[model samples]
Target chain A: MKRNILLLLVIFVGIGFLLHAWPSFSQEGEEEAGYPTYPIIFTKPLKAVLFDHKVHVEKAGLSCEDCHEDIFKMEAGSTQQNEDFNMDSLYKGKYCGVCHNGEMAFASNTRCASCHIGVMGYERLLKKQHSSESSSEH
Target chain B: MFKGFADWVKSLKNEGVEHIASEERRAFLKLGLVITGVYAGGKLLSVVSRVREVYADIPEYVDKYPYKPHYSMVLRTDRCIDCQLCMEACRKTNHVPPYGWRTRILEQHLPSGEGQWTRRFMPILCNHCNEPPCVRACPTRATYKDPETGIVKVNVKKCIGCKTCMAACPYDMRYFNEEKRAIDKCDFCWESRLSKGKFPTACAKACPAGVRIFGDLADPNSRVYQLVHDPYRAIWVLRPSMGARPNVFYTIN
Candidate 1:
């Protein structure tokens, strides 16, 4: 009975360790896992803005730690919830402007069209997503 | 008879020559303009003088560019935010690979009174020099300057991927394209857009900020010409000591 209890305790300890390491693994936010795969869209300035995690993190060689829990929360679209998540804030070197102010990366004030896809592009992207989903279902 | 002919030639020269002092050229010009304005509605004279004022720095009144339309770019460095839309646009328009870039933005850390205003962005591309070192370095004559537009172009078919031109470039703008088996760099979006009768390059059009001013440097009416020729504006080129005579001009404004 003592041996069985010890085995049970070991199993519990193993599970607990796995749980502790879980957040760090997810923190990387690699697209291979397929969580947060789509572009995060912001629609405050009447024009839709797109933040592509894959492009910045993967293509541009940025780390998840570069933004997560510091500049932005790990929760997707958490930035849009903040009142200061606007162009004015960006110009002042807050949020995206932290690196994008022509220092670490491209400035937030410049390249407005690349990120600000406008309502038309947003709708087109929505249509595309819908079409792809419907096609996958078929 | 020879003396009479010589005197007649001298008199012919003197007829057109205004005896008015050279220092009073501006006054003469103003007076002539007023007379022409009164007689020929003055509109033509005013326009001509304005154009002359803009182009007074250029010595060649007839033609500054040997090429018909000399393609050039002027970058307003202060306005760049480093958003890299120009880089993305170039990649998309030129079908550039992920590893390569025809144009890139550089970040400059300027010491400021306040630390908040310390960063600046500079956009860089192929200079397309008057005396292009890449053109001289090309063994197979793959890279050559277009006489018509004065654009340095790569004849990809002839390029053996030697990377000699890449080394020759002072700005380090060229890259070896494994797919094309040639040295690839910014052709100012010539094949993708300019040949299709496009006015400005893809990068210039894509920039949200009015940073890249692309136009014919030879044309007095062009924005590039006006910006570069402006005595008031502090215009400069990268690595002037190289003596490439780069066509691309950079300024704060």
Candidate 2:
């Protein structure tokens, strides 16, 4: 009877561990399904800017059809290749300015560091990526 | 007896300012002075206080521009995008090592609303303060502020490398250069670009955003002067309470 109690305790702890790690497991599943779960960092014309698909989709309640192939192409970083991908273009109601026109969202001119993460943010992101990769290797 | 005296004073008629003529009040108001209170019972002692309009950051001494050129920089803080092109130019021009930085960008996450935060990037460099604490801390007399151009410079040969200036610096702009065997900092590109007949510093020239406006503060026509002197724009300096009297100014367009 003592041996059976020990097995039951082990099962309880195992179930607790899985419960704690359930969110990360679901995130991994999303990544595997080509959901663009990771943040897309753009580097062109300037050092960096950040775009989060999860924030747009889940938080802002935007569907894939709203932006995909209409506002932005399906492939990431492709828009940056064009010559008019700079801030002047944004002010003229192009790219991010399409929605961020002071009505739907905050104007692109204001809250600069929100989108333009700058070189420091770029370096921090690189460091995070390196650490995560090294931890995965172990 | 003192209590009886106080009671007698209280019982006396309290003559209000109705006797004072409106013309006298109007004259005082025109001179930007207000007669706040009358202390000596009558109009004999009127506390006329001057209503002086003063910007806290712009000190009275700045109007003199002690140095001839009075080299200064006005930063449009809002325009800074943190691309780090200025930093790269400074590194290339000054030969700053990978570990060391002449200028740096700091990030701040300020709360915008409920559960939301806004990011701001602040770029910092040597302010070349009028009363530099680093110059005061140096034991070897290695660093000195130039009287002609007002640029605080270092004489590397005289430097003892004691690192006291590094500790004394309010802005944390100085670093020990392993190659030079002395403390190095941003000289506003004096040694690299300015001394070579170049108009503006490398960092200022390299910035694509036109954030750093470098010019003589003494000159009325210069962009730096106009930006700082503008009444509408709010101008401020970092660590003004330190009493450094920083030449570098920050404003938003």
Candidate 3:
């Protein structure tokens, strides 16, 4: 009976230990599970050509730079974003900054939905994902 | 009585050590099986999701939506006229920064039969591979393949800028973005328009000739899918010998 009680205690102790770790694990989120980012968002309304990353990459001979315009150099998960409150000042003559101007993605247009649509949402999603992801790890 | 107690204590100590050693040995064996079990389990889950699925570690580090290729870049080699308008258009449309030529035109010099020298231009970009080498070589789990759309992409967040994927690639398509410090390759244009349920790449739209076609490979209704599957044609991917098994199928005449 004593041995059985000790085994029961061990099981309960293990369960308690894991249960204690549950909330923290849940808090880690899924997107933050070791993902990289380039946080530089376009302050200007980038209303140029809508490009599909998967098709051109697979069907056409174009690589990433073929269109993203060397906004930043190709590094492993490079994320060097400058804080430019406006669009023209942010990307002018700097990679896509030259072409996307009001005419392209480098426009001086200022609309929260236009400039921050995909970027802001995507960034938030990544963060939320990561939090849940870290939790699931344990 | 003291001697007897001492002997009893010594016996307990010996038994404890023996028990610990056996437990450790058993634990070592259990560890091997546990690791194997995890790997097998992960593989099975991924396979069930169609081998293209990612096997995430405990951290769920796998991207929720891995890259899905969405565009087909085609150059009218004959209509190119060597003008490089396409190049400028691509650069302007996409912001392909300086010194990093994303669309490199291959000028094939042809000695005109009439003694007039002619050049045929072939624009080359990242050949999004079916079995992408860049995706395979990333150590930090930065590069990934989107099973839904067949697009291989890099997670700028996780990439350490090691350039292993660049070196691993065969077509020399992968570019190292020095400023941001990550290996850059084509992921269609999902990064910019991912939230809109849209599928368009800058290069495909910039072409005035309407030569480029972008679509889903899995969907038989897609133009590219029908084109690639056409039995009465000869289409080719760059460097088939590289074993990278690229998805970019160029219909060469």
Candidate 4:
């Protein structure tokens, strides 16, 4: 009976890890109702560049197909690993510059503070997420 | 020997070139010509004198401002993300066609250390210069500067589509609009929005970064005025040598 309890504990811990690791996959169905308020964080050139999907889609009136399969991939954090994933790429009319250019949107070069969010904004988001997670557990 | 030295000094002073009459010296001074650099007759001097004549009527820069509501734009160039929201807003507000753009962003790259690179973006549009070349070049007076607001506006009714304004623009901002059959460029959104009581231009309103600060330069409280007038800020305009005296200013900060 002791062996059985240990096995169950291990199984519960593994499941918890899986849920935490893949929040997007687990929360996909729920987020559909909320619609595009998700903040995507990128770690490059420095940690925590926040891209708000809600502002682009809901406020700016852009569709999913507008960015997907063209400028960026559907998978999150995939572009960060690419060799040309930095500001250089964006300036060349790739990535975010595809829309952010003054011709299409606000040029990426003009507003460094708005979307850069920086490491501080990243930490704040992380803290908010941690507190929410702990509170939810309680 | 002392008497001989004094006599020699007096003789040297007497031998000096004849002094000009005081009235002649006063007349030269009145012409604002310094003697050291002045040559009475030369082709270059004639050209310089004619150029001075052309500008002599113009008032000092500080006192030359004629517009009451001097519409101006200050661009914070470093913060641009190159999102095209402003472009879309312009098109929607002004009905700009697919082939034409009133404003555009230019990208430049500089190599940082460790094989990394830095990207910079600059947005360009009609500068609406105080001495607009486009307005002066237009034969039909199709493009003219609004005296009250200091905005360069295209009178489509008067435009013959000679494209003189397009060629004359140092910024290359004007384009011959096929639909309008006139050279169209940015008018600070005067007809579409400004005249309709909107404060910010379409592009400025759509800019998420607050990169484009648009306001009246005459207003001391306006951000545009503050940014342009700030001593700490490195403010500059494009191609200042062209003598456009652009109302639009750019700042790195």
Candidate 5:
């Protein structure tokens, strides 16, 4: 009876280990769900209006899969922001710079005052310039 | 005493004849006691080991979110193309490497006897349950649900990436990010988008079939809440009887 009980215990543990056989299982599932968010850094002056993707999706009679297209359906915080977002390079069509370069999506040069107005997180850029001007004035 | 000890072991080894002859009716009690003592000792050792586990990867998020029986994304079966756009969209939105898929659309072809083509499409992702089993299996506090949004999230930065939550999950929703050596899964796009003042997951946003709907499950005015509350709508979850009490709802046509 004692040996049988030990064997039963061993079976339970064996089942548990078998149940958790895949080491990459949970993480693969988690990654599929969305785990970590890779940080993005900007190397160029390419800030757009805070596009509330939800407004167009839920309230505006649009589906969630529209504006996001292909890229929006990616993992969280994994977007590459530092990719060169310039107009000359963008005009040829690359990243957000390509279409937003003025012809296809939105104009890059024509929107200086748009993002530069401060609501687009470019206020920090302006503040730095302003402080530099004041300091050089002295 | 040493001679006596050797004699006892020798007797046990040669037990076929002498042991059987020596055994009496009362020997059963002695065997029973031995078995119970062994069992008790094992239990004590296991409890101690569990208590002393330093880097146990348990879920610390069970105490975080309040329970709810509704979910956000609803699978509209009739509109599904089995294209797996949602799965691709989720990867794009999250930048998930090709190691594994977080969301997948399952296709089932009916036997060709009905004189009509019937392909069943099932889009599966984490159901963000009111009581997620993955939350219990984690020995470390890596997996947890968000309080404000009620979405399940893992602290990938802190996770040792143990597969405990995967075992604990009845829906088999949890996944691992082998590249980062951590766990990953759906946060309903709420943790990254909604809570961060944005909205629409990549899967929900890029859904060409318009089969998936992402909304706040909390507010009555939210599209997801309305969908969940719809009396005529038939909502379903994977293994609804498992008692995980998931918040995700689906409209299977």
Candidate 6:
């Protein structure tokens, strides 16, 4: 009876530990899926724009292969270096327009604020990052 | 036998529409009354008797030009990206301190749809109102609307720094300049640029997106006049209910 009770106690403790560590374990799993867990922020050509890998990958059901090596380079923000990487280019079925052509997703011209978070958003993001960093340090 | 008519009526069950379900009541009420919502107290309910009309009429000051070169600005609100280049240019040209701002961008997250929101940046500055509340509120006559250009200006020498004008301003555009020891606000870059024969304000010139269109409102050919006068375009000023008669207008292109 004591041995059975010890086994049950061990199982209950294991379950409790798993429950406690679940969030961090899931976060690690997301990172291991080969995409950055944090939203990628672009600052070039404008103050800022936000791109979420999770939104495109999980929500929109897009794979890395869909955008990689063709529409966008494997390296992030590489498209921004090009002079043609702008709204005009997007309207002409290039870059973001490849998918965001009103059919696949919302057109680039229609919902501008969705991506263009602007200077204020950029500053807010910086503040958030700073706060998170300080908190983690503590 | 019944005692009387009053006593007989009182004896009957007091069944009114009060016991009806809210959904059934709403269905009945939907015919004439537009029920807005039930308030927290549960006693207070709001109903819109008539459909609120969208801005269908032209602005009051379409043809009226009181000042000779009535300086005005029309912001194409949708075009603004909140890059803040205009703010930087204004600061550099006008020597605005870090603590103070003659112009600033406001960020808003407007509800786009159910469980969704969209971000927008609105740039605001001194409206240079036709009937400036700040001018009327000034005890020392330090702030005045210029008769020549219609630009509201502050006379720093006359200013006692009472900040009455700051409080009176409907737009909340005025801020105290600690260095000057006076309440400072945007004069449409008149002291720095416009008086120097420069057509547009520093902020207007610096905007890469062509968001700010500054021109003489009196001139029929000017872009500002055309944009404001466009019958199809919905031109609106901030806080129109305040009736400050703001010269600055906002529109989306």
lDDT of each: 0.76, 0.83, 0.52, 0.76, 0.56, 0.83
Model 6, DockQ value?
A: 0.43
Per-model TM against the reference: 0.54, 0.75, 0.43, 0.53, 0.45, 0.77
Clashes of each: 6, 0, 74, 28, 50, 0
**What lDDT does candidate 5 reach at residue B170?**
75
Candidate 5 docks with a DockQ of 0.01
Candidates sorted by lDDT, best first: 6, 2, 1, 4, 5, 3
Which parts of model 5 have CA positions greater than 4 angstroms off?
A1-138, B1-71, B110-117
Candidate 3 stretches with Cα past 4 Å from truth are: A1-138, B1-79, B82-86, B92-94, B110-118
Q: Assess chain B of each prediction and give its TM-score.
A: 0.74, 0.78, 0.62, 0.74, 0.67, 0.78
lDDT of 4 by residue, A1-138 (tens): 999999999999998887666655646753774544456888764555788777887789988888887877877767777888877678888999888788988886665756665444567789988886775553
RMSD of candidate 2 to true structure, Å: 9.6
Error of 1 at A22 (Å): 13
Worst 10 residues of 4 chain B by lDDT: B38-47
What is the C-alpha lDDT profile of model 2 across B27-123, one tens digit per residue?
Answer: 8777767665443366343445543333322445448688879999988877788999999999999999987888887887878799988787778
Q: What digit string (tens of lDDT, one per residue) describes model 6 on residues A34-108?
A: 786776788877788889888898899998889988998878777788888878888999988999999999987
B142-234 per-residue lDDT for model 1 (tens digits)? 999998988999998899999999999999999988788788999988999999998699999998668999998888899988888887776
lDDT (Cα, 0-100) at B24 in candidate 6: 54
Candidate 2 clash pair list = none
DockQ of candidate 2 against the true complex: 0.58
Off by over 4 Å in 6: A1-29, A32-34, B1-59
Query: Over the stretch A24-132, how does candidate 3's per-residue lDDT look in tens digits?
Result: 6644542353222223333222211222333334554555555443554454223234444233454455444454455644353322222232322445556877886
Arranged by TM-score, best first: 6, 2, 1, 4, 5, 3
Tens-place lDDT per residue, model 4, B1-253, is: 9999767544442221124455754565567542322122211121112223222123433335578788989888877656656787898999898989898877656676988666666778899999999999999998899989999999999999998888889999988889998888999999999999997999999986678999988887888777766655667778878998888888786
- What DockQ does candidate 3 score? 0.01
**Whole-structure CA lDDT of model 4:** 0.76
